[model samples]
Target: MDKITYDGIRNFIIENELTDSVAISLHPDSFDELVMDYLDINNNQIERPFEILGIEILQDSTGSVQKNKVNILNVV
Candidate 1:
């Protein structure tokens, strides 16, 4: 599957209000698995823009997760 784009996720978050009242993203370091873990749609829809970023998935030893830095700056 194609890696989820940053703009795609940001747009989804704004439109669906998924981030509303949600303090942190549930994203993990293994972002690929997160697609199925959080999204409720079928396989065909998994790659769509509606899926939110699971940023919090990358947790540290202290159980605190950092913000998503992968595509944040569009360095790639």
Candidate 2:
């Protein structure tokens, strides 16, 4: 699994113009667990609440299971 950093995720949202959207993960396996782990690791450093949108199964061009794609939404 690729390491997804907090800064990287936040920057993605900002760069993609998703400032008002909640965070999301599109991985069938352990998407929630990954998000929780991320939060647990950076719990003390972060102040603002980062909400998750939802989870879905994502695939690559070759039809292989790809890494979870994190997105955002305006509400839950």
Candidate 3:
């Protein structure tokens, strides 16, 4: 996806308090379509504009997942 589209999806996830792992369920074709569909339906009601730079997987010393580290920035 393009930068704007990707950023918009990231912003949507943040706005709805969803995690990256959520994509597992809505994968491949449906995820992007869902985001675009939601944007179209809601007329892009993204209250907070933000850019997701990256998602860092934080694992413990034993290699178990501790939590996810989302690198993000507020967009103007």
RMSD (Å) of each candidate, 1 decimal: 10.6, 7.1, 12.4
The per-model lDDT (C-alpha) reads 0.39, 0.43, 0.38
- Model 2, runs deviating above 4 Å: 21-23, 29-33, 44-65, 71-76
- Which candidate model has the greater TM-score, 2 or 3? 2
| Best-first order by lDDT | 2, 1, 3
lDDT tens string, model 3, 1-76?
2322445555656675754443212233433454455467568853222113332112123322212222222323
Put down candidate 2 lDDT per residue, 10-74, tens digits, no spaces: 55555665644343444444444445566677764433344322222121233243455553323
Q: Write the per-residue lDDT of candidate 1 for residues 1-76, one digit (tens) a residue.
A: 1433445455555665553334233235535444554454454454433334532222123334443423221111
- TM-score for model 1? 0.27
**Which ranges of candidate 3 are over 4 A from the true structure?**
1-24, 47-76
Per-candidate clashes, comma-separated: 4, 2, 0
The prediction achieving the highest TM-score against the true structure is: 2
Return the TM-score for each candidate structure.
0.27, 0.40, 0.28
lDDT of 2 at 6: 47
